[model samples]
Target: MTPQQEPPPFLGTWARVYWGVVLYLAAVIGVLMLFTASFRL
Candidate 1:
């Protein structure tokens, strides 16, 4: 048997790694902002 390598399941390419990282950061930032606003009250 031989080994095989595959890219991201959804993105289908290595570029998805960078995209995923950026999207994750954006999501985290958005969540933090919401928390900050809620606490400011």
Candidate 2:
């Protein structure tokens, strides 16, 4: 008997979701910084 190994199918989907969250957070932080900088100037 031989054992077979296969990669998980949800790996790609989860990776994309994780990246999306990171990008969204970065955008939000950037907007906040811009707003704060404009107010300070």
Find the candidate with the highest lDDT and give its number: 1
TM-score of each: 0.61, 0.64
Q: Please report the candidate that would top TM-score against the real structure.
A: 2
- For candidate 2, the C-alpha RMSD (Å) to the true structure equals 6.1
Clashes of 1: 0
Worst 10 residues of 1 by lDDT: 1-10
User: Which regions of candidate 2 are displaced past 4 Å?
Assistant: 1-12
Candidate 1 lDDT, tens digit per residue, 5-41? Answer: 6555677766887888899999999999998899885
What does candidate 1 score on TM?
0.61
Local accuracy by lDDT, each model: 0.81, 0.73
Error of 1 at 35 (Å): 0.6
Clashing pairs in 2: none
- For 1-41, candidate 2 gives per-residue lDDT tens digits of 33334433554565676877899999999999998899884
